[model samples]
Target chain A: MNNRLKILRAERDWSQATLAVHLDVSRQAVNAIETGKHDPSLPLAFRIARLFDLSIEEIFHDQN
Target chain B: MTKIDATHNLSESAPSSVLRKVLITIIGGLTAVFSIAFLAGYTVAVTEQGGLNAYAIGTIAAGLGLIGLTVFISYKLWPKGTHEAVPAREKKSQHILWAAVVIGVLLGGYMAVASGDNPDGVFSNEPVTASFAVISIATWLIIVPIITWMWWRTIDEHEADAYREGALVSAHVYIFLAPTWWMAARAGWAPQQDPMIVLVIVSIVWSIVWLYRKYA
Candidate 1:
């Protein structure tokens, strides 16, 4: 899985830590998701979607 | 910059950040040394060896060398002043965990040194004074459970998942290992299994896997 999390954060001028705080997660968690080492759970995905005011599909995409 | 933005600048090279790096390096180095020593001791015990052999020395040397390399790399890569803001509640939880770990390691080291005269070292069958036994039991049976419960409750979902995966892998290893060692002992092909050694090995495996999942 790949996501535009880094790009999204950068667009908003938000550091990983800033986004992590918004999501109530560790910065490491945000980094892992951004790097594709971890996939967000459904609830987290929803949160991320809500945060960016975009659908989950707009933020995250399957590699295939 | 906003307050949060101020906290995220890694290029500052602040005095506080320098102190943090030094502290991290010291703690990480000590942890690596302790882990290696603990594993080496158990390896010798499990093999029924009398002393450190060439292999043990080589392993220790390699492990220390690796630790040195890791420290160097971490130092090089770490930002000078870029610690991200952790929520206050989560920060408190982290402090408690570190305090517990430090206490545990100190107590363990004290026990090993104090039991120097005992043939079986810290696990000797020799009777301890009543007060010592009470203190030890209280720490292990009461304080440990409370701390463990707090730890489980405080960790985030990612950490919980890492712990679960680590436990699963270690449990499988133990399931196969204990039985094989027992059967071998029965057939006079190996020494009897020691529960303590088995526990240590399993714990090490769990820690390794958990760290990998969390960081890698």
Candidate 2:
């Protein structure tokens, strides 16, 4: 899965750690999602969407 | 809005990260093997030698007391009403779990060897020394599992994934190792493999891989 997490985070001038703290997760979790090494769970995706004030579809995209 | 292209950099960092993970896992696995084997052997030697002195009793008491104190302190300091990760709390949980495992194994192994009457009288497991049985039962069956559950609950999804992956690798390792080991022993080319030793090895391998994958 590919995500616009990095762009979204950068737009708000938020570091990965900042995003992770706000999301109630580890910085590693945020980095994993951003690097496409891991896809967020449904609840986590929803949390991300809520954090960025955007829909999940707007933030994440299918690679295939 | 212009994209900053942060994702592209992950590819550049990934190979090095993978290599580091592999290296750590290998190192951790080797460390586990040596530590576990040496402890198991030492426990055997101690039991064969027989009588437990004041030093052994004092060491056990002091160690268990210290662990209890540490666990209590960490639990007291745990973040209140917050579901977020607390690194210190998690580390404490890890420490508690390892202490339980190592101590439990050593004590249990010693108790097992010390059990029953020794013809040599180096250490006779008389009726009065039956306390080893109770300690073994409580520590191995009750305390260990309870601490293991507590430790398991403290981890997030990523750590759970790492554990699952590590377990899978260890399980596969056993499937190959045990049968080959049996064949080798049967052929008289190798010493018979101790089930306890093998179990310890599997656990060590799993932990090493799991920890490396989680932290690295």
Candidate 3:
């Protein structure tokens, strides 16, 4: 999965640690998601979507 | 974007940044040297008297080096006030984990000293003493389970997922490897399959997977 998390975070002027705090996840988790190494769970994806006021499809694109 | 890139380049070339990098590299090198020396000392101690003493000395040196590295990394990563926003549960979990590590290190020191020259102590299944057996059994069978439960509860979904994947891979490896080793032992192509060695291999594989998934 590819994500616009890094760009979104940058637009908000938020560091990974700051974004992690907002999402109640570890900084490493945010990094992994941004680097396309791990996909967020449904609830976490929803949280991310809510945080950015955007749909899941807007932030993430399926590789397939 | 160009301004940001220029700023990043300027920061990288700063004297303080250069000094910090140099210090980190030096400390990292020292930590590696201490770790290697600790392992070498342990190997030598196996064939010599006062193995406990050697272990104590090695532990101190390695422990100090590790502590220094950990402190430096934490300082560099968290800065001063950045950690204040960490969730209460996360802070509690970190505390518990640190306490566990301290307890484990203390227990290891006790075992090294108490085991002495008992061939059955550190490496073998044979009981060293009644007290040693009690402590070891209590720590591994009771305390460990409780700590593991707490850890599982405190960790986020990402860590839990990593742990699950590690467990799955480790189980698969054990299933295939154990049967192969058993057949090889029967054919006299290898030594008899030792349960302890199998357990160690499984554990190492599990830990490698877990760390890679969690950190990489």
Candidate 4:
């Protein structure tokens, strides 16, 4: 549930909308994920990691 | 309401002069209210007259005219939305939704018009009435639901979540609202219950809440 998605997006100098476009999700979805209001499904998580050119662990951390 | 962009410290003010905006909004609101009143009165008055007359025609025209005026005033006061291009897929899906809506209205309108005065169900033996009845039933029961389901499946997860949240809200509202209406009707303070109309009302609320969650 805890992910550094916001930081990763910022590191790439991307707006949420920009990141959302790449991820094929809404800006609201990206915001919700970053804000920890929702967690991405496994496939989406893989897609996000692939987009960032990192492994899943690099992008997401288990808060549990 | 102010929108705060998290990515940037963006500040946007009203595009029009504040005083002019306020004046236009007030005038537009009054016009819209009057148009609604006229339409309501026309419906009742025209029904009592048992046919279309000068009074009915004039009332309909006046109501429509005021509505047009309000739309014009609203356009002048505040333009609709941003010029951001909706994705082509989204646009296509929106078109589908619009098409379904238009079809539903046409079918429903035909049924209402063909029913004569009181539609005695499919056994009425009236050709136009029976045909429109079948079409309207199919429109609502089959066509509309298919279009809605298609629209729901095509949206992103966030938009779907908005829909889910909307459904939850509507469900909660109906839990209280249906009982209150039933209580009131039982006590003779309200008219008899119509399940179909209540369901329609709930559906409207669901859509409204979904839109608010998506765009708010």
Q: Estimate how well candidate 3 is docked, as a DockQ score.
A: 0.35
Between candidates 3 and 4, the one scoring higher on DockQ is 3
What TM-score against the true fold does each predicted structure earn? Answer: 0.69, 0.58, 0.69, 0.64
Worst 10 residues of 1 chain B by lDDT: B7-16
* DockQ of each two-chain model: 0.22, 0.22, 0.35, 0.22
Error of 3 at B154 (Å): 1.5
Standalone chain B TM-score for every prediction: 0.62, 0.49, 0.61, 0.59
Interface RMSD of each: 5.1, 6.3, 5.9, 5.7
RMSD of each: 8.9, 9.5, 7.3, 7.5
Name the runs in model 3 displaced over 4 angstroms: B1-90, B118-120
- Which residue pairs show backbone clashes in model 4? none
- Return the top candidate by TM-score: 3
Top-scoring candidate (DockQ): 3
Whole-model alpha-carbon lDDT for candidate 3: 0.69
Candidate 4 stretches greater than 4 Å from native: A62-64, B1-61, B70-89, B104-128, B175-190
Residue B40's lDDT in candidate 2: 41
Give the per-residue lDDT digits (tens) of candidate 4, residues A1-64. Answer: 7998877877776666567667776655676788776788889899999998999999898887
Which residue pairs collide, candidate 1? none
Each prediction's Cα lDDT score? 0.71, 0.63, 0.69, 0.66
What tens digits encode model 1's per-residue C-alpha lDDT throughout B40-136? 4555563565666888777657766776776677777555544557755457667777767676766665554444334345555566778677878
Kindly report the docking quality category of candidate 1.
incorrect
By TM-score, how accurate is candidate 4? 0.64
lDDT of 4 by residue, B130-185 (tens): 66658767777998888888887767776788789989998988898899999999
Of the candidates numbered 1 and 3, which has the greater DockQ value? 3
Candidate 4, residue B73: how far the Cα is off, in Å = 4.8
